[model samples]
Target: MPPSAREAANEQRRRLHHEADVVVVGAGIFGCAIAFALARQGRSVLLLERWLKEPDRIVGELLQPGGVAALKKLGLGDCLEGIDAIPVTGYSVIYYGQAVGIPYPLNAGADLGSTGGDTKGNGEKPSRPEGRCFHHGRFINQLRQACAREPNITIVETEVTKTITGTHNPQVLGVESTTRNPKTGLREKGYYFAHLTIICDGYASNFRKQYINRKSVVKSRFYALELIDCPMPTPNYGIVILGESAPVLLYQIGTHETRALIDVPENTPTASPAAGGVRAHLRNVVLPSLPKQVQPCVEAALADGKIPRSMPNSWLPPSTQTEPGVVVLGDAMNMRHPLTGGGMTVAFSDVVILSSLLSPERIPQLGDTAAVRRAMKEFHWRRKGLSSIINILAQALYSLFAANDSQLKALQRGCFAYFQKGGNCLDGPVGLLGGIIHQPMVLVYHFFAVALLAIWLVIKEV
Candidate 1:
């Protein structure tokens, strides 16, 4: 190829991704999913990412059964394959010293954007829904690969500086981003235009505060460590250990590697460096709290002298999308504690709802700002049935599991005991946690039931 022709080709590539029918910011979980969904709906997309490399993170490792189902619905289920992902069937909760197994409800189908979920039965899906766990980076890479294969989608590596809006109204026109020049191999400023822009820039989003006007509240920070060939008390389940110093989540990400995330709330004295730091917290508080068989592995991993990295566990409720021609999705818009691993489930579910509401059949043209805003309003309300339920339940359970107050402790005991009661008491709560059941009333009913039971237990002890 001649130099002039080569330069011309490079310039053409830049122009190609500079404009599209829809511009998606931040190719994280929601960004990747939505870009693919909209592309499949016959819309050209520019999926922009600040860094176009595989991401290594803690929060997105576990995909609840509901999320997996939604992924399948988007025709991206194959992303779960060949990543050495492990299947998550249920959760084993260990409280102080006692333990209980809360497997997912049998015969429950994935919500799949259906109203209130299929509480009865969907003969098409498996009777028992199964979740999947893997390295967060691997899973995301797979999703990105799938997006690359799509003809309508062009993935661009760029850092979005800010959004560009019309002077007349606050409606966003597109974005001003820093796109690297393919010819010079140096960063250069460029602009991307599209009819609609969706932001899914993970928990720490740059455009969120300016657009959504909601702040993410940090509940706690989860410090993570990787254990090799660690033997757990159970297989095919996410192990939740409460009363063992905050809340600990253990799930296998691969055949031999298990990811252990230990939650350390802010200003914790035990985790303070002066008080021997997080290692002391793990040695004194977390070590003894684990099952005896798993003790050696935690100790060995700690002995490696690897100081764990931490990610904030935050709660950001859904705010209405009033900004015309621009919408915020994923963690940028809302967040919840990772206690039940509901973030991905809620994200995928949101995509299902958003995809349905914004389908070409309904909106027809991506350029219609009015139709887009109306759909977003509908999305804000339509998604509440699942998003609110998951968000509320994740926070509430984190409160109960990590309860410090005496009353909360009592409720925590009752929550565990409620699971022990078996039947709907166990199935209902677990189903909601795994994102299998969509009924909000089920969460309310069980919460009240646990409170009442806690009262009885307290009185009986007194």
Candidate 2:
């Protein structure tokens, strides 16, 4: 049946009011990346951000080599140019007073496992393989600037309140947002209609439940501190110190500053801020376990009496989406423990896959529900190939490093021994950790190999 004249007029008015092909909520890394990618492809995108100022949160400081490559592919490589970001060569894990260095694969480049002949073998020098770490806010500002440079992208400072759903179907037709006046502090509600809506509001997303029916589970929390003038024994390498109540991660985030994160169990009681709780814990328990070189820095930071910032570590497994005209990306859709530092890598890889699937050449009209649905289905399955490895590794490695159980403790010892072996065993796992290797089978093989080694060691000890 044909729509009535009144209904057709209403549809035209809605389309005129919301003159965009896609409405993206949240202007964080994921949202900005998506908006930038779409706009470069000649699609009109409305990017809504709640805060106009730079965010001061602690997470999203590291970007894996794979993420850098994805950024290049998205034409946003310059985002890392002026952020004063530090190059991370590899990781140094200290277990039971012993340390082993696991570096990213020697010849690994932007694209891993591609059939480009080894440049070294071809008489050409290979570039150094490395990742990056920096202040999270600076990186975000870089991305926002990149998004704003595109002519097709519109940046709006507003807080999205809810999704405007269709009366009959489950599809999200648009979004409702509230904008506040900077001078008068008055707020006004507005509606922006679009053919598609993307939710990238990070972990505390409000629109996730409307499309995804699952909730994020808080597995643990991280207490973070900044250590000034604290340089690691090996520069450009991240340090993971085990044997504490949980794992403590230390990495140089700037030339003169290192970021230290201590994992605290979710059920554990935290001290009150007024009573010097976090400082006491660091002084009493965490400091003794850290390397001697950084002890003074930790001591100074504790004595400074600044409360360490706390962030919850949550995990949300991915699910196949059946919702039409809506897509969820970044930490909101799926998350894993940050022990592996693979969150932003996964999010960037997701954007790469999704943008390719919904490229302008493929689906010219964003309103084509059937085509977008098909692309999203493919995106979901194709993304798993890479995301599963990173997600599972983060959880599994955290279990071993945390070593809450007897079996996990054995596994932890075995893992250290495997890294000490220093051949395919070490390179393969580090490659996966660096986000260069996308194969889950390789991860599974190395994981079980470590387990078998652990079993052998336990038997020999007995």
Candidate 3:
């Protein structure tokens, strides 16, 4: 190619620029929800996605009851329909061979009704107090479709390279992107100018470091397996098994398919079918500990010789922000272990709070950095009410279940015993886990109570 022609092409690419009130990067759950909410309020939104097709992944499969309520408030209750999603009533936990059932609080139904109302206008709620779980890809597609239906939202299929910033101030002005044709392999560069840029890219977001200066630490990893024809002892309840090696979670994702997530230490040897690695680990360490009804499905899965999918479990402590005109959210902003299945719940809750703060009545002009910054300040604090509870509970619970020390194991026993008490004791923690409760102090109180119970039990044994 000649230099003159190359220069001409560069000039053409530089001339391409689009504008919107808000530019949202990544079309995952958070991005889609935020775009839908903003568009519904008559704001012009540009939602960008690298892949126009539905996403396939193992995470974000479960939506807590609280998330369901938030979805209804957003008028997205119907997204849960036509997906063959399964209802999750509560949890069935097996600790050291003893088992107990913890149901969602009785007030959950009323709570849903209070906030959700009859979104369908049929005088009935589309969701129940119970949660729902389905294929992650299908759920995300529903959210993307919802955004596509909004008149104010423009969906773009492209890759966002970086944020466009102001000349003097540190405020964000827009985003730069690149588009590629799948058939001809042609690439084009473009820019999107907006008053505010919202980043909802997933856990591995590239824009996160540009906005926040914190690093996510990997605590462990989860190996996922799909078990066909698996039936839980309690059909409606998800199961948490605390065995000797690590904790295992089992829940039905479809009518005939169940998903099992087995926690593996970061240092554990990788599973390989060639060396009989996964088979040996399951047969020797995991299989013997499972309940009788679940053994057959796990055994069949092992015999199939396909290695399970693995995902890193990471934690990022909340951080303060000083940047203006840019808001980083979802897993990109904060993440907790998937053991509690709260990722989607946290994301939805963040959208609910952020959308409310960014409503037209709150900020008349989208480009007003002063107003957006002020609302962001309130958003940062208000989000903690729910995010903190869920974050602490997930970390604390994973510690108890993945007990690596004798002290933690004792606490794990105490935790199970505490649940076996069968009243406020179980309901309190379960409510927090299900996203109904938002009190951090309530979580601290329950945590210490379990510790005291563990100490008491240990002393009695000695």
lDDT winner among the candidates?
1
Q: For candidate 3, report its TM-score.
A: 0.91
C-alpha TM-scores of all predictions: 0.93, 0.92, 0.91
When 1 and 3 are scored with lDDT, the better candidate is 1
Output the lDDT of residue 250, model 2. Answer: 89
How much lDDT does each candidate structure score? 0.85, 0.83, 0.83
Task: Kindly give the stretch of ten consecutive residues in candidate 2 with the minimal lDDT sum.
Answer: 109-118
Model 1 lDDT-worst window of ten: 110-119
List runs of model 2 lying over 4 Å from the truth: 1-16, 110-125, 269-277
**Per-residue accuracy of model 2 over 402-424 as CA lDDT, tens digit each:** 87788888888888888999989
Model 3 local distance difference test score:
0.83
- What are the runs in model 3 whose C-alpha is more than 4 Å off? 1-17, 114-128, 269-279
Q: Sort by TM-score, best first: what order?
A: 1, 2, 3
What tens-digit string does per-residue lDDT give for candidate 3 at 1-462? 675564344334323446777889999989999999988886778898989887878889889888888888888889999998999978889886788998877755656664322245667544436789899999989998898787667788999999988999888998988999778899788788788899888899898888889999896788788889887877878889988878899999988889998887765553444545755776777888888888999888777676678899999877656577788888898999988998888888888998999999999887898888888889889989889998988888888798879998889888888998988897788888998888888898998999999999999999
**Residue 253 lDDT (model 1):** 94
